[model samples]
Target: MTEQPPPATRTQAQRTAATQAKVLDATVDALVELGYAGTTTQEVNRRAGVSRGALLHHFPTREALVVAAVSHLVDRRLVELLTRPRTGHEDIEIIVEAFSGPLFDAALELWVAARTDHGLREAMIPLEQRVTDALAAGCADLFGDRYTPAELELTVELARGLAVSRILRTADADRALVTRLLPVWKELLDRHD
Candidate 1:
């Protein structure tokens, strides 16, 4: 056979990031499908298709792995929230709609589990605060002038509540109370503006 060129190599950081993403994404998938108790490192490793050594190298314990996954999921959504192009209006819709996805489902699982699991709660506190801070800053930057600081904070709170209440929805079209309230909130905001 003719001589072939060597394959291009990824940097160590790239390899590390790829492995972490695989693991974290798998963890989120498990959380959404299995809930907190079901999302063990074994399940995560299997879902991620990575060796136990690799998973342990990055995340020593189940709690560490879980918290990291929560952080990863929220950060992924934040990038989408912050980087996407937007028109002059649609701020409320965008903010609320962003929360109505897998991140909300996964985070909801964690929040419920954290209530009694002291270790998980301890690990989750900083992650929750970090996510909140990042979302606050991102909303301020992306939807500036459309809402005052208080309005933005309240809007984010409303969106969070909407996401939480969405669990009560039975059918896809059941329209959780928050889903109905969002349009009214948007209309009121539009009238105010």
Candidate 2:
């Protein structure tokens, strides 16, 4: 009989990175499911199925973990936006889809929590600015010839408002409503052309 090969072992750095990624994924899930006040280290540990010692070793504090998770999320989002293939989609469609997702839900949770928590507010400003700046840059690049800068800004604001409305929406119907409204919004932009 042929001998089976031994399983590949992960390096120390790789193990640490895997642990950190698990923790951050749990952190974002907690924020989206339970909001800021509900996302405790214990909860993250529970969700990640990692031991307390491991959790503490990776993230010594709840604030540190939250900020790191948000930073990680923002970095991922920026990469996605900048690297996405140009498919000639409408500006409103791209912008709306960007703002409507689990990350947006997690971010909204942080935004609400940050409004009251001074430390979180301090950490979130730069992150929020980065997202806003990326959105603006993406809009300019995608639709600069067709839409004015002011118009793009308006669309962004409107998309944000629409995304925020998702927080209290009734799910399927509201989603359909938002989808239908996208074309209506694009038509308004077309009117200016």
Candidate 3:
């Protein structure tokens, strides 16, 4: 009988990275499902299927985990936006939806929590800036002179406001209003070119 070689073992770094990824992904999931107040380290550890020791080894504090998770999420989203197929004349709704969907909801939980938590606010400010920069870069790459910087920024802000309103259940995000505004927004874009 032939002897089987020993099973290939993962390097320590690979194991560490895998653990961090699992924890971060679980953090985003918890944030999405439970919001900031409800997402505890124990909950994240449970969802990640990692031991508390492993979680603490990677992220010593809850704030560290929260911040790192958001950074991870934003980086992933920026990559998705950059790599996604784009039509030259896509509708505003498509862009709005892309910006304000599930990922945004997850981040919104962090933002709402940061409003009162000074440490979280400090951590979130840099993350917010990074996301904003990534979005601006992505918009430029995708649109390519179709809209000016100010116009693109305004569009992003509008989408965010709509998202926040929807999150608060204060706005229905009426499709009719969006439908009516799309043509006008497109016309504005055309005029800017």
TM-score of each: 0.88, 0.83, 0.87
Question: Candidate 3, clashing residue pairs?
Answer: none
Worst 10 residues of 1 by lDDT: 170-179
lDDT of 2: 0.84
User: What residue runs in model 1 are displaced by over 4 Å at the alpha carbon?
Assistant: 1-3, 171-179, 187-193
Q: Which stretches of candidate 2 lie over 4 Å from their true place?
A: 77-86, 191-193
lDDT of 1: 0.85
- Tell me the deviation in Å of residue 155 in model 1: 1.6
The TM-score-based order of candidates, best leading, equals 1, 3, 2
Q: Evaluate residue 30 in candidate 1 and report its C-alpha lDDT on the 0 to 100 scale.
A: 98
Candidate 3 lDDT, 102-172, residue by residue in tens: 57878888888889999988888888898888878878877777778898888888878766766545344
After superposing candidate 3, which stretches have Cα over 4 Å from the reference?
1-5, 90-94, 168-177
* Ranking 2 against 3 by TM-score, winner: 3
lDDT, residue 86, candidate 3: 72
